[model samples]
Target: MSNRDYSLSDVVALLVESGDNASTFYRYSDDVPMPSVEVLSEIVEDLRTVLFPGYYGPSEITPDTMPYYIGSTLDRVERHLADQINRGYCFVCDKNKVDRCQDCETRSRNMARAFITKLPEIRELLLSDVEAAYDGDPAAKTHGETIFCYPSIRTMTNHRIAHELYKLGVDIIPRIIGEMAHSDTGIDIHPGATIGRSFFMDHGTGTVIGETCVIGDNVRVYQGVTLGAKSFPKGDDERLIKGLPRHPLVEDDVIIYAGATILGRVTIGKGAVIGGNVWITRDVPAGAQIVQSRAMQQSFSDGGGI
Candidate 1:
């Protein structure tokens, strides 16, 4: 082990050899190109430009020039998105040999076009989210401020775009897109989560919305709120089951305050108010208010009983 006895060539050869120990971490294929985080990040930015024209990408957009700008941006987005989708398809095919896709190019193009078709609807939903943020927060001065300054809108925009790709069957790209937003905003929303319009998250930091969560319209949540699973169901083989409804189902007009965690497939009924710093696992009735008992006692002691 002395420095004089060490051979650099031997060390390099030893590391380059793909033995059983090294096989798990290596991909030996060169036929399919891997997806690039840098390119996908650019694609997400271009899409955001198309989704909100005046805010991102190009700044000066007039009614006469908007169509040209949108068309050019969408064209670029579709091309890049198709390449990433094809990479995702090739990756899946390399992993699972049984159900290999023959024509990833055509499939990727079709999926990308289908996702593009969903842009108008996605923009409508995002506008509702912007309106929700403006109406729900007293500190918000204008809708433009929410669109430009709020992390919730940025996170939701990424979620909505990624959700469409998820539905269109573009596999790894959607999760990458979601993770990009998560890395940027500290709000983790799974692509598989079904969230309705007018969703607003105020001070949305450290919030985790698990897959299989179904949230209805006009739902407002604060920072440090978690909508997660209570337990994992195991089969006879002792492996955890996949794709089961494990997360909570939140109904319309629900307001979850900061530092609250709702677990399991329980329902938070319509018009229910979940107070701050509470943990809920069971279903709350419609119009019910759930809070900490100590907070309730303190409220009553202060002559502010509910």
Candidate 2:
């Protein structure tokens, strides 16, 4: 075979090798399915349409037709989400080699129903988020524009749905949902993070909110902001520990500028302003403004040597 081509035996060998490697890098099991990224993406779109009626929803939806569209959209969301959630449950069970996963479908249905019920609450939070985005940005033309055009809204919409699933204790699917938005919007918000009302990300890109982050209400963060962990504890076997609160606890009304990395379990107090490119590891008191230090300039007389 040439360098650009492969023989039949070689292709079969490559496929067999990849199948073997799946046990290490991926999940694989017979009779059990994994969560489909395409299905999850569809679910997100349906939920978005249901949440923001008349925006991405049916064109004929009006005061009388709203209920019909909402009901149908929610039914589709529940069906698709329940299937994916069941697959997520089965994926975990298969990984742990648990033989009893017969109840996964039931649990998934219940969780999906619960999540569907919370759509109104999620919509309310998103509305407030839209208002905050409009209020925070000077260039915003209207609240509707912010809702339809802002990347922050897109990120938060995905986050809110994923967070609801996370809170319901569903495995694998929440993270996948969060990543879908991250891939599209360049905002990396973990589903495990808890964000409050009126949260806004202005010019949001290169923003990394870690898994354990707890952000408060009315907080606005600019682009390239990282609310991340400083370090993670390791086990005696040299495995990194999980579930510790490592990311920052940002309180209400705090503003973190671009490229500011606030690490550890430190609390960013209410009303504090973190300047751009600042590396913060300690707790900040309320109303504090952290900025880069002043630089000193030295004038040289000699052109030949230092």
Candidate 3:
């Protein structure tokens, strides 16, 4: 070992130059690939436009050709979704077994088929989300704007779709969907979080709903709200606990305002309203309104007192 032909710095430089950064924009490496958000977003746009017709994307949807248009759009979405899913599947597959792709192909088909089968239900959930946003926000004139512009709607839509995939046991795909929306909207909703019907996240930004958080129906949350873990549970080896219910359980009709961080297994009771910037670790009674202040104000009104 007199002298190395290539120094450590020289090897590092070569590695960086050969990495993903050196690739042409047209080509992407699966080893460190960009989530096909641009492609998937277009798919979602087309799919949503088809699903809700005049209420979501294109306004030129005609009654006579509505069914035809929807069918065509669904077909295209299915193809596009399946293609990307297959790419993801193969990417994550054993690099050495790339030639044995039967399993990957089957997985992709099954995943795509399951997602396609759940389309009607997904649309129903998204329909409620649109209604919730419209009713919650005064500026939302119509569902069209909510679908197009509202960050909450986008985040929830991605969560709902991703949750479905997660339930189907398609790993990574769900995160990709959630992260895609997160990149665009600045809202972080884990697909594993359980959120019930008629939920509304008002002016949602910087909101983080951790995995294992259970949110009930008619729950409303505002911007900068976080339902996170009180403390990380570690194993005998001292590794942080996994798959535990670490976040808050917000019951039906609970309203949490901006900048509120409700941690632990605490239950914000049914019809409770949590005000802005408050950090809560304990359980709350039903129909209680906890506002921010030195006084710890309680309005005694369920949810928003509405």
Candidate 4:
């Protein structure tokens, strides 16, 4: 098969040409490989191994070999990340600036180094997450079980690491890292979401935590739960506003259960328990417990919205 252009504008054009109707096959427009996504995943996995030496990749790593291994991994990671960052810079930036793009490569390396320096902090945060999962679920046998097996913990770990890079302004790669976890774990957490400590997820498949969502400490979310946006308000240029908080504010100790979809900028109050398959657009008071009523049958939109 021949290659086709599938840029976002190209896709929009195709849809318009087809009278706003397109098949599932039509939805896929480009076969061009995205190497950056895989490279970002490999870099993150390398860091994960370095962070949890005995648990993630190689258990036999010793102090003697640790420096060599770390140095080697960092070397490989920097090269790959620099290439991706430069490519992304080339994509969204001015064409004239591309020829003189000297600083991006350096900036990418520096960001990678900064992320590496923060591994200890990542591990510390993950410890609490592991503990939270262990305690939150009766089925979780141990902290080891949570670390080794839980999909939510795995997804959250990647998000936490990627979130740091996202905050540090390394464009495009954080989403890649999060997508890597999404592919492996069936959990899609946006890299830009601000998650706090001791977050626990239970049976976390089909959970979509959107960008701009601010989750407070000790929040527990279950399968098919979505902390997402309402309607997107467009600006004067018809472009959706960038960097505004669009998703839900999930407060501390809230337990959002399976298939619950909370949208808009509504606050899910502290200690509230949201039940399965419920659609919530309005704010719930603290200590509120919301359940779905069978009397109200609405079409289930996979992407959560009211």
Per-model lDDT = 0.90, 0.88, 0.79, 0.79
Each model's RMSD to truth, in Å? 4.0, 6.0, 6.1, 7.9
Candidate 3 lDDT trough over 10 residues, lowest sum:
297-306
Give lDDT tens digits, candidate 4, residues 226-267: 888889989999999887888999899999889988898998
Model 2 residue pairs with clashes: none
Q: Rank the candidate models, highest TM-score first.
A: 2, 1, 3, 4
User: lDDT winner among the candidates?
Assistant: 1
Candidate 4 weakest lDDT stretch, 10 residues:
296-305
Model 1 scores what on Cα lDDT? 0.90
| Candidate 3 residue lDDT tens string, 69-155 | 888888888787777787666555533344636576577777888888997887888888788888988989987788878888778
* Candidate 2 Cα outliers beyond 4 Å, as residue runs: 1-6, 14-22, 295-306
45-82 per-residue lDDT for model 2 (tens digits): 98888888778856677999888888888898899999
Q: How far is candidate 2 from the true structure (C-alpha RMSD, Å)?
A: 6.0
> How well does model 3 score by local distance difference test?
0.79
Question: Whose TM-score is higher: candidate 1's or candidate 2's?
Answer: 2
Q: By TM-score, who's the top model here?
A: 2
All candidates: TM-score: 0.91, 0.91, 0.81, 0.79
Model 1 stretches astray by more than 4 angstroms: 1-19, 294-306
